[model samples]
Target: MPLVDKLLILAIGAQVFLAIAILVLMGRERVPRVMSGEIPVADIAVERSGYPLKARLLSNSFDNQFQLPVLFFVGALLLLQLGFVSWVDVLLAWLFVALRIAHAAIHVTSNDVPRRFAAYSAGLAVLTLFWLWLLIRILLVPSA
Candidate 1:
């Protein structure tokens, strides 16, 4: 596997970890509330709590994993399928993964909108550039 492909796999792993973290946090927050009769079982899916702030943050972060990260996954796989490996590609892939981790940290901790948006924007820019590079390679470079 190419380095870029490995980075994409790590990125996907990060998302999976985030999802599991969300589930754990949700149960921690909800189970106590339910036992206290503060909320009904049917309302569990509604994503609210007497202290809903953390749960909402986790939910939002989990949802973000399926967004631009999808493009990152697809772009990486396309490059691998076409055998377009390059150091630049690997660098950008790592950048996207780092920025995504920072984004999640900001989101789940401080919940600062501006900081979170900046991190997400930086990651998106890296991913977009990766796609553009892949397109140029596919369209212009002669395959060996």
Candidate 2:
């Protein structure tokens, strides 16, 4: 496997860890109530709190991170088969993974919406670029 593939696997592991943390945090009666059902009266008035805001942010970050790896994995495999893998693809894959980690840290620690949004935008841009790169590369090259 290429280094990019290894990095993607690491991203998967990070995502799984975050997902488990989210599940544990959300299992709490207070958080689960807000997430699943109607807001309890105490929650409405007092604002039920658990796991802090950072955990929630991490949860969202993980969710976003989970989708990109799956897409990138497919793209990588297709590109590999085509014998057209490029440094750009690997760079973009790593960029997306790095941004996701930063996003999660910012979300969980400082709850910085602007920073999170910026990271998310960057990740999305990388994804778009990767898709375009793959499509153009495959289309422009003759089939074997």
Candidate 3:
């Protein structure tokens, strides 16, 4: 397998870890209820003391992180199939992962909305760059 493929797999693993962390944090007996479903809000509030605001925000950040990896995986596959692997691709992929981890850490620990937002914005920028690079490469490079 190629290095990019390895990186992509690693990205998926990181996402899974983030998801599990979110689950565990919510399991803590202090998280609040914000979802609506068959389970009553009161029941949720009672069952779990409910998460701190920071925990909830961190979970949401992880959710976003979880989604980005899927998109990156698809983009990576497409790029590899097309035979174009650049530093930008690798850097952007890893950048997204790093930013997300940092975002989750800041959010969970300090409820630092501004810092978290900055990290999220950086991740978004990387994703946008990936898409643009893919588009440009596909259009400018001749098909095999």
Q: Model 3, stretches more than 4 Å misplaced?
A: 29-41, 45-55, 66-70, 80-83
Candidate 3 global CA lDDT score = 0.70
Question: Which pairs of residues collide in model 3?
Answer: 30-49, 30-50, 30-51, 31-50, 31-51, 32-50, 32-51
What pairs collide in candidate 2?
54-108
lDDT of 1 at 129: 94
Which model, 2 or 3, shows the larger lDDT? Answer: 3
TM-score of 2: 0.62
lDDT of 2 by residue, 1-144 (tens): 776556545654665565566556545634655566556545445443433454455455556646765676677667767666666777776676677667766766777789878987887788789889999987888767
Residues forming the 10-long window of minimal summed lDDT in candidate 3: 29-38
lDDT of 1 at 112: 89
The lDDT per prediction is: 0.78, 0.65, 0.70
Decoy 3 TM-score against native: 0.70
Clash totals for all candidate models: 0, 1, 7
TM-score of each: 0.80, 0.62, 0.70
Residues 38-138, model 3: lDDT tens digits? 34566446443245455556556556655766777688778777667776787777777787778778877876779978987888788889889989988
Top-lDDT structure, candidate number: 1
Angstrom error of the Cα, residue 126, model 2: value is 1.3
After superposing candidate 2, which stretches have Cα over 4 Å from the reference?
Answer: 1-52
- Error of model 1, residue 84, in angstroms: 1.0
| Candidate 1, residue 45: how far the Cα is off, in Å | 3.8
